[model samples]
Structure formats: C-alpha cells, structure tokens
Target: MTERSRHLSVHVDRPVAEVYAFASDPANLPLWAPGLGGPLVHEDGAWSVLTPHGRARLEMTPLNEHGVLDHVVTTPSGERVHVPLRVVADGAGSEVVFTLRRAPGTSEEEFEQDAERVNADLALLKQVVEAGAAGGAGGPAGA
Candidate 1:
C-alpha cells in the first residue's frame, strides 16, 4: 500500500543557494522547525534531536548543487520516516518544497495536523532566511 503524500511549498525571497545553504544545515533546523524540539546534538558523528517522541536520529542527504534536502528521521521506536525536501530556483528567489507522507494507520485528522505543522515550519523558514539576508547574517552560526 502506497502512503498518501502531499507536496507543500513556500516561496522565499532569497537565492536558491542561500536558502539551500541554511536549510540543509542540521544545526539550523531548530531555528525554523520547532516540531523537531530543541537544538541538535552531535554524537559519534551522528545528529540527533529530542522530539516529543524522545530522542530521534536524523540521517540527511549530502549537500549538492541540486538543492536536495532529503532526510530520514528514525523515531525512538525505530521507525524511519523519509522526508523529501528541496529548494528550487524561482527567478531570483527560491521555492522550498516539503513532501509530507501519511504513515500507515494515520488518520485524516493526523495527516492534516502534520501538514499544518510543516506549513508553519516553512513559514518560519521564509521569515528566517529573508531576515538573515537583510541583516547580512549567513545563518545559524554563520552557516
């Protein structure tokens, strides 16, 4: 059974490279995505975050010029959920797309709630990237 998926995107008034640079950094996730809990912790060369579901490990795709920001979140229960994201050029700005998938047994209400949370996170990402561009701050820790 294929899982239901939704492609949610936001347009940011920043260059694709700039947007990708910031969003691809795991260190910057907490700045825009609050659903991931607090700051990231790096241990034994792996990144982890304290989500409401407890400590979850994150496996991210390698940085590339194509603006792929795909990642996998390994839940405490050992469920690995793939998150597909991208930053594509939109004229002088960029479009950030996040594909949210409905896991098996997830209700319609739960899926909708997840989409809402992703939308909020994307909005915050736009705000942060635009603000940083204006203020000349590279990103989290000058990323």
Candidate 2:
C-alpha cells in the first residue's frame, strides 16, 4: 500500500448546526483552535491560519449542512501533504471525524505523526464547542 490513513473521532455537545457552524466558519477557527493561533485569513472561501508549528492553507467547500475543508500543510521537513475534513451531522450534535492519509511514497509513521496533530486539534475543538462556545448565526460572538 502506498498510502496510509488514520481516522479520529470526537463528540461535541452542542447542536449539530452550532458545532458545524463554528468549525466550518473560517473566522471562528482561531477561537476554537488555540493551537492554531492568530486569526484566519480567507479568500475565495479558502482559509489560511498560522499555527504554533507554522501555516496551513484550507480549501473550504460548504454545502447545505455538509462541508469539507481540504488542508494543505507543510511538515517539519517542509514536505507538503493533503488532508480532508469530512463533517457530518449526528443527532442533536455533530460527530467530527478526521481521516489522515499520506501521499504516495510517504511512510505510515509520518502520516501517524500528522494524524496525531490533527486529532489533538479536534480534541480542542470538541472542548471549545462542548464548553458552550458555539451558539448562534455568526457563532458565540453574535449570540
């Protein structure tokens, strides 16, 4: 197998829309994602955020109640890889699951390392939304 992937899951105790809205909206990313410090820069629906590690460019494509944020990130060694955010609603809240797959020729260890970071980020996301941050139209700020 040339590619290796890992999936991580977390349950957020907010309404599905609330969780979805906050996580999908680029502007609110920085608030929930402390590890990805600073504000998010969006252009043509793509968001660029600076993290403790460096920078990540996300291509957001949102549909009615479903969306995916395609991520382009540079590893410590400066190699670029593509990751996807598959967001789906579950009952009252949302179950966010991230699948991390390595590019062809990349090793599983590298993919796991990256996936760990992604998992940690999602864990933080769950904490933020479940702790009562996600609420209204433009997120908690507008609430």
Candidate 3:
C-alpha cells in the first residue's frame, strides 16, 4: 500500500501567464483532459464533475502570481487525492508539469496508464493554450 508518483510535462509555445490563465481554470478541463474531464458543474463555489467512477470534486489552488495549478480531487467516498500541477516560464514559452501519484492500492499497470493519460492531458493543454494564443485570445499583447 505504498504511494508512488510520476511526472509528465509538455512545452507550450505561449507565455506563462497566458498558459496559466487557461489551464488553471477548472471549468476548462473538459476541453483538454481526457478521462477525468467533463462538463463540470459549479455549485456553492466548488466545481464538481460526474466522473465515470462517481461524483467528484475538484478543488484548485487560488489564483496567484506564481504558476501553481495544484488541485485536489475528492472522491464520492471522501478519499482526497492531491494533484500537483505547475505552469512555469521557459524563455517566451512555458512548460506545464503534472505530478500524478498512485494511491495506496493502485496496481502497477494502472499507475503506468495513469501517467500516459496525464501526458495526453498535458499535451492537450499545450494544444489548447497555443491555439488560443494563435487566435489572439488568452491575454493582451505581451501579457
């Protein structure tokens, strides 16, 4: 029942702030994330989604100058899992990293598959942010 972790990253050809502005919004998850994403519902100040497993809540970090996009997922059974995410500057572009931790009882195959899924999610995030930037969205010029 030991916990293990993996990290996946993607480089987005966009400014850090622009990437953070888009990726940090939980409501935009379904546009990028694959398995875990959904048409999220916001009620009572918390974002909830009807996950395949059950109803789950996404509690993201507060907006800040730092590019910390960390959040916690609370399962229907009250199990809380911490998802460590960050968007940081890389020259004029940015790099997004997602840390996926295998819960106490997850199998090895499941953990590996989870890492792959997270990688896909990060790639999707990069695509979404870059597409937004190319469309003259995300922020003002040089923002």
lDDT of each: 0.85, 0.65, 0.80
lDDT of 3 by residue, 1-143 (tens): 34877778998998887888887777778888866857689999999888777889999988877788898989988988888888878888988888888888789999998888888888888888788733323422344
Model 1 deviation from native, Cα RMSD in Å: 4.0
| Steric clash count of candidate 3 | 0
Top lDDT hit: 1
Off by over 4 Å in 2: 34-39, 42-46, 50-56, 67-82, 137-143
Segments in model 1 whose C-alpha atoms lie over 4 Å from true places: 133-143
- Candidate 2 lDDT over 9-41, as tens digits, reads 787766666776777776777766555555567
- Clashing residue pairs in candidate 3, if any? none
Q: Residue by residue across 66-143, what tens digits does model 1's lDDT show? A: 888999999999988889999888878889999999888999999999999999999999999999832322322222
| lDDT score for candidate 1 against the true structure | 0.85
Candidate with better TM-score, 1 vs 3: 1
lDDT of 2 at 54: 68
TM-score of each: 0.90, 0.69, 0.88
Looking at model 3, which ten-residue stretch has the lowest summed lDDT?
133-142
